[model samples]
Target: MATESFLREIGGKSVVEQIVDNVTNAIINGELKPGDKIPTENELCTSMGVGRNSVREAIKILEAYGVLTIKRAEGTFVKQGFDSKMLYPVLYGIILQKDSANQIIELRKVIDVGILQLAIDKLELESLHKAEQAMQKLEQKLAAPAVDINAIFEADTAFHMVLVAITQNALLEGICSYVDQITKKSRLKAIEKFINDKATERFLLMHRDMLRVVKEKDRAKINEVVEKHYQYWEQVTC
Candidate 1:
């Protein structure tokens, strides 16, 4: 495949940025693809009419973003499949934005609803069993004589993770993982509030509702259940 079209000369200021844009565009346009080796540093410099330093910097940035992987002595290649590192750029972007908390809530709702729909369509008995076990563990944690907030948090995370796993879609799971990290603090706050308000059963019941929705394959109730699930989270975060 001819590389000249996609690797055209990148001119003007912010040479490194331009180079990065060029490579990303190629990937988006299918000129480049996952696992495909990118041009050598010298080739990039020559093709983009940029300095070797600029090309090297662009390559390093892409590698850090998980867009490109550098293998020993083999050269840089477009990364194949999902990389947790890829989430960092997006994670930081959202974190740094003003008034991002509410936006994150909305984002979570959208992702959860979509995930629930997918899980319902692809439901399996084993996955349903795991979700049940997760709920049981959560209940046991809540029912302890001295409720452990940390334990509850872990159990809560596990239950939701099992829901995401039910979809059997790796990309959705990865995105959900990203959302989990971003919302970690707010979710803990919400859980703490539920405990302080003596609403542990309510919390458990919300999760039970999720399991019930999944078990019944009730697509109509997904939005309602997800909204209820994030109630305390919205209250505390907002």
Candidate 2:
């Protein structure tokens, strides 16, 4: 693959960044493709008219983000499929933003609504059964004489995870999982508050409402359910 035509000369302040952008653009524009070996560091330098160090740094950054992979014997190639690591950059960027707490809450509401909508359309008997089982586990955890906050939290997370899984979209599941990971601490805090405030039943009901909306295939009730679900989360986060 002669990448000389796709690679362009670089003349900019952020030469390394420009090189990175060039490679990314090439991939996006179909000049480079998944499983296709990229030009060597020296070749990239010659084609892009950049220093070797700059090209090396650009490739390293791309590799770190799961955009490219380097084999010991073979050269660097574009990664072939979805990688959870690919979302780390987005997760970190969102976490670093100013006033991110409120933003995260809003983002979660949107994601939840969207996931529910998708799950409603794609719901299968087997998946729904799995979700019901998750609900049962959550109920038992909440009903325990001496509640384990950690156990409840894990059950709560699993219930929502099953809902997202029902959609059967790997990319969506991956994105939702990472977003959930970002809010893990706040979520645990919110659950603890619920237990301490004697509102564990309310927490369980919120999840039940989610299951109800999905089972009923009630799109109109999604927003209402999602809003109610997040009340505790927003209380703790914001």
Candidate 3:
């Protein structure tokens, strides 16, 4: 009574990507519910009519995306939703250029501001205190004499990551992993070129203002500061 979808017709990486797409859709659409065990590797290979290597590769990719989990002595199981961490590196690798990084940062700004606005209503007192402490540390780092750009960059990352933590969303945290890695790499490259006191001061000042904005929890202000901060990297296209 049902129409059959043929997997054999799909080609190349398309076939592999198709496998991921099909399985992903099944999980997301509830056709393959979380915790539901999927067919065995051999069964999948038989159904897909693809080589065992293809099925294995597809499974690994799915596992990276958090769409499926494979356990020893058991088969693979679908997850309710893909985890952000699983998606981050892939997402980052897919968009690593300067322009794309800028765009991703812009997107993150919007998302983070919205998240922070919502979180303000639910931010734990301890969370606020922790954020405040991070801000203080950032201030001290900025005021100190010239140090390794790596140190400065790490502090900067911690500041934003702490703000993200306030939302208490594991998915958001994971999604940030790739973006953070790329951003840090780009930042180190950019700062390495400008380690002078003047450039360092400018960087420190921007971070100081960013920390102040986050602490205020002012939606509009935070968005503006975040945008400005991310725009800092837009000039590094070379």
Q: Which structure among the candidates has the greatest lDDT?
A: 2
Model 1 has how many clashing residue pairs?
A: 0
Question: Could you arrange the candidates by TM-score from highest to lowest?
Answer: 1, 2, 3
lDDT of 1 by residue, 1-238 (tens): 2354688776665899999999999999998999999888878777777898888899899999889999998988999987877778887888789989988888889998998898898889999999999999999999999978888888988998999999988777887788887788888899899989989889989999989988999989999999998889999987
Q: Write the per-residue lDDT of candidate 3 for residues 1-238, one digit (tens) a residue.
A: 1212333334566667877876766665666777877777776677777778877888898887677888888778776554774675557665865567667666677666666675665577788788778777766765677666777777777877787787777777776655778667777766655465357666666666665655565666766666666555655633
Per-prediction backbone clash count: 0, 0, 0
- Give the Cα lDDT of each candidate: 0.87, 0.88, 0.68
Off by over 4 Å in 2: none
Ranking by lDDT: 2, 1, 3
Model 1 residue 158 CA deviation (Å) reads 0.8
Candidate 3 colliding pairs: none
**lDDT string, candidate 2, 1-238, tens digits:** 4664678777665998888888889889998889999988888887877788888899899999889999988899999998877888887888899978788889889989999999999999999999999999999999999978888888988999999999988877888788777788898899899988999889888999999999999999999999999998889876
Model 3 worst lDDT run, 10 consecutive residues: 1-10
Give lDDT: candidate 1, residue 122. Answer: 82
TM-score versus the correct structure, for each prediction: 0.95, 0.94, 0.77
